[model samples]
Target: MKKTWKRLNLIAAACGILVMSAGQAQAMGLLQAYEAALINDPTYRAAVSENTAGKEFRNIGRSGLLPTLQYVYGSGKNRAEITQPATNFLGQPTGGFAVSNYDYTSITNSLSLRQVLFSLDATARYKQGIAQTNYSDAIFSARSKDLVIRLTTAYADVKFAEDQLDLYHAQRDALDEQRRINARMFEKGEGTKTDMLETQAKLDVAEAQVIEAQDNLLNARNAFSAIVGSEVTQLDGLRAEFTVMPAKQTSFEEWMTVATENNPEIAAAKYSLEAAELEISKAKAGHTPRLDLNAGYNRGLSDSITTRTQDQTIKSIGVQLVIPIYAGGYVNAISAQAVANRDKARADLDSTRNRIAIELRRQFNALQTSLTKISALQKSVNSSTLLVEATKQSVKGGVRINLDVLSSEQQLVAAKRDLAQAKYNYLISFLKLRVAAGTISIDDIQTVAAYFSPMS
Candidate 1:
């Protein structure tokens, strides 16, 4: 009964693995991974949060354009101040006392509003905030683009590894059958020892490759799950596709132009510069005077039981001027810092443009090379298969050695693997191009989905 139970457990485990594989088939794909990242990726969430904070900054500057209001209401006993008195006419020091004291409590309340008459710095600062918000939005979009590329790369790696595993397994299975057939021939005394030994050697090699392929699959899945913010117990098999052709005639200068105009980092740097300029303007305005307008009206009575009589309401309007004076050089230092930051931002913009151009060219070259490689690798795989078959027949006919047949088969397997890697590289390079161009957003998902949809 115990032995039977052990066999039953083995069957159950196999069934579980098959079920899990089926579930994985319906799990999220590369596009879904990217979508999950938008909400689940910690880095992306932080960028979005920072962008939200930037939006609030614009409201702060709105105060300069809108009216400022305050409500004031108060009632207190008016007590005259008394200080030390000098000698009176009698040559004796007079006692310090309140000279005249009367009930002087009045209820005063008002809502005073002040609007800016002229403020250049305030307007500039607001524009700067607007620019900052726009810049953060661009950053968030760029981050999303980067995340998509990452997901694509990771997803592709797992699929590539899986394809390799399949190839290895197939090769191993073929060797297993060869070994069985050779063993049967040896039992019948029709096969030489050399043939059976070579078959056994190949079986060993095939088993080793299977183990290696499995390890690669495990590593690839681990990486994929890490990036997608979820555990990947199994991976769905995918076809080798999703490659795009590079432009036949792409000029470096044109690429640079596009990057400078459309790269989010460049736009963000420009916005940072604009924000710094606004800061300088604000600091410069620190030396200027400000005019404040105010008004108020009050109607409230004191709650003293002894004096139940109510106080009359009072209202007042006035204008006030604020003149700037020496301020410990703080404002000057801020203006200098702003100027320095603006210079740095300009340099960053230039540097970012250079980097973007370089990346575009790199991805373009990689994609082109991979395309050619995939084509060549396909031919090699076909040619290698023919060679392997011919060599196998020749070896069986005693025209070739067993080692030669094994070597040819190994070469064929290697060709298939190389082709798989080249295909994976091609897809990765294509994704890099989209990311470099700053176009890998939800729009990329839509485009990919459209391409994958039924041709009918």
Candidate 2:
């Protein structure tokens, strides 16, 4: 029982450390998420790991330029036998005598070192490793930008759902009030039952809208949670913002220039081109001669009993050179393949830049369109507000029918909805333009959120 408590404490400590880790962060904004993801994201981390492993090629190449040292030792015992005629210094051939030794011991030890003078393959691979590292760094930056776009879309959806839900509630309340007024009029024999029924039916439709809005909100919340690695249970609306977006200072061409220069996709493609060039150089390096130096030491000890025994030690040092002889043209074929691949990489980069420019044009136009719609819609709302008031007064003067007032109110609701949609479109278009301008940073997202602060 005491051991169980100790184990539980240990487990809790581990969990605490895990939560404190950079990658385990809770809900974060787009920029915060970008920072956290750059630190914690598995794919980027894996690329970093691969980059680190690739760097070992530097050491491997440098090894050929450095010395290799070695030491060795051995000991052994053996038996030997010898037969000879036994004679003194006087050279007396007395009789055949034999001397047999049971055992003898031997020991040996040695050390040696060697270094290479020239190796083109090693030089090329070392340079390639440096290039690969740079490539991986560029890829990491691109991934973070991608995360920003994904999270922005998800966050916007949540806000849209929230706004739709609010509209439903507002419309529903307005209809409920109408139904109550109509009910009172009918009781007084001043209004028809049909009027009450119509208001009630509209209220029911608004309630259904609320239900659908709730479902959309839930789905948006889930998407955000998946991206930010945290559950989103609460959402704050941007309420204070009720204005048209200002026009852009720069033209579409200038925006495209900025996007092409700073966008991550273009940067990634540039790096890929560099990597392919390096690979081509690497493959061609295979045709070059490689030089290496190796050294070894060995020692042995032996004991022999019989005729004779001896112990010995051995040492050796050497330099080796390998020139490509022939391998069914594999080297040439690979080098040619690398060249073709480099051409493909370059072409891919061109295609990517073109696609990016097209998107920038589309999004820029969309932003401009949204801004124009917002200005027009603002004017429409003001006119519609006056029209609604005029219609109500006419009804009081017995010059307008009740149905006419209801129709104007319906038009007002529709205009307000159109305004809501305009706001949504403007929000989305502004973000798109920022994305095109390579200004899709967390600060830009926060700026959007700030526009809604008045409502908050």
Which candidate should be chosen as best, given lDDT against the real structure? 1
**lDDT tens readout by residue for model 1, 328-416:** 99879988988998888888878887788789899878977887898889899889999989998998899986657766776787787
Q: Which number leads on TM-score?
A: 1
Error of 1 at 367 (Å): 2.1
- The all-Cα superposition gives candidate 1 an RMSD in Å to the true structure of 11.1
Off by over 4 Å in 1: 1-26, 72-110, 163-216, 233-249, 303-310, 391-409, 439-456
TM-score, one value per model: 0.72, 0.68
| lDDT, each prediction | 0.69, 0.66
Off by over 4 Å in 2: 1-116, 170-207, 239-249, 295-318, 384-446, 454-456
lDDT (Cα) of model 1: 0.69
